[model samples]
Target chain A: MDSQSIATTPEELDRSVLPHAHEHPAFLRHHFEDVGQQREAASFGMWVFLLTEVMFFGGLFCAYLIFRNWYHPAFVAGSNTLDITLGTTNTAVLICSSFTMAMAVYSAEIRRRGQLILFLVLTIVLGSAFLGIKAVEYHQKYVDHHIPGLDFSIQEFVHPSNPKAIPLAPDMAEKTQLYFFLYFAMTGMHALHMIIGIALLFIMVARASKGAYTEGHVIPVENFGLYWHFVDIVWIFLFPLLYLISRYR
Target chain B: MTEKTQETHQDAEVHVVKPPVYLAIFLALLALTALTTGISFIDLGVFNAVIALAIACFKASLVVLFFMHLHYSSRLLKLTVAAGIFTFLLLISLTMTDYISRAWGMF
Candidate 1:
């Protein structure tokens, strides 16, 4: 390690010493060795943050698993009340949004400014649509008095309207509240993430329209795509666990 | 690694996933979603939940691998994701051991 051999100052560093100096775009941070290092560091940091998110959501999943096993019948009844059509529709909507987000990232990478903006806007619209459908589902729950701690009633569970449905004892019927509680907690958290993702999408679209991400600075767009996809992945698990698992049972 | 080598490596690593690939993955995910929903209505007994989760896992893998570009990502990022999932499984399994061994069906 010859200290004197390396250029000690920014001005001293030039194409003569660093042959690839011209490739260092202005957006590259000074502390990073190059664009690649900067991109990797940023991606690594984002993933670490997402890992913490995994743990956060994992706790909720663990609780749901234990309780669902303990009160299997209550869970089945509670889950059956959910509108499967809406649930499936929302899942498809979110999957489409993820597809649009991937296209947005691709557009940014290829430096197609118009396409980038278009896809970002599309993602935002689809995300909002997802939230709109979720609102309808929550409203249905409200109308049925299924919101835990608000105005919950177990009459439907106690004497189910479906002829083939198995009725629950009053005590078991009360356990349905726990199922609804987990449902609201998990889906509410997921919805909050979608709301945040949509809000960020607006900002990304604004910046993308200004040629921000298309000019060889695509890290922001790429990282946000990761986030949007992560949210979609959460829904992938969420759909089956909350809506699909107990349907046939 | 020299600056010149890093520049060349960066250029090599920037593999732009095409629109067709994204579309293919998207369609596959939607199909899997529909399949899982469909299967949930059939009373497969214990396997109903199992199949639903299996399909969900497959759907998530597609998003992660292609859409999220984990397939093209560096090993460091790949291991980071795997580690996160490993820890999550550990948490669930460890807790279950305690719960399952104690009171059995008492809950």
Candidate 2:
């Protein structure tokens, strides 16, 4: 790098500079106008990407609402089959993970590298715990034959083992399979996002421990925080829709 | 690897959220979760699903407004977020018209 080209620090790049004379961080791409513009563009792009993800999940949610309305009794029976204890625990776990992710972003903004590492680690742990509980829940579903297109048995819905269990006709109980299909499709999709988020968190934690996100280069951590929180929001809706659908009935 | 030399807020400002605010939001979310679970035991008639979804929307709004920092972000960013949600609502509402109308003997 020439002497003139080497002088473009973030401050220099932000100030008045004649064309290529401005300096920037090594991580800055050649296409960006400057650090600020790069950060803005990166964030904007992430939001657009997140919008697409929203629509992707929206399709599943739309199907859920339609089917639940059509087969309320079957849906209710299928919902009750879920272990609310584990569902609630998973919800709390995800909320905590979202909290840790926000704290990680805050630490990055403040340039607290140590705290950033700590927060990222905490977020990953919490996220993994949520997935662990979810696995247990899924395992129980497998044992009870609730997995649609698999060994899904309608016996539970048609003939309740519990006195308080909601009753459904055998035909309506067969519709419970549709409910389980949506349940797996929705929650499984959410879990897939969580798995991917945790994997990305590992990469961020490594870089954060090396003090990568501090010093005004927090765009990465900040963008990832948005994603982590989006996943949490999905679960926020999912818990109530799938686990708590008219349980009192 | 480039070293993080000096702290610089050269171009834009990053909001540093307080710890207490996050803790408060976390607690509120947990409490709401518990409330939803507790209320599920008492039949709210046809309003059960409505109340649960309302509570969920409330909790999600808190996370979006504060934790996500959309409150402090640029208007464009806020608009983008709003657009996404609006589109989702549109999808739901438009499709529901068909489902509900069919049940009304529209065919």
Show model 2 residue runs off by greater than 4 Å: A1-20, A30-33, B1-12, B105-107
lDDT of 2 by residue, B1-107 (tens): 12231122232344567889999999999999999988887888878888999999999999988888877766667888899889888988898887887776422
Best by TM-score: 1
Residue pairs that clash (backbone atoms under 3 angstroms), model 1: none
Instruction: List, residue by residue over A1-249, the lDDT tens digit for candidate 1.
Output: 011222222344343245464555556666777667777777888888888998999899989989998999999999999999999999999999999999999998988889999999999999999999999999999999999998899999999998768999999999999999999999999999999898888877765665577776688888899999999999999999999988744
TM-score, model 2 to reference: 0.88
B25-44 per-residue lDDT for model 1 (tens digits): 99999999889988988899
TM-score of every candidate: 0.91, 0.88
**What interface Cα RMSD is found for model 1?**
1.9
Query: What are the candidates' individual DockQ scores?
Result: 0.67, 0.46
Best candidate according to DockQ: 1
True contacts kept of each: 0.79, 0.76
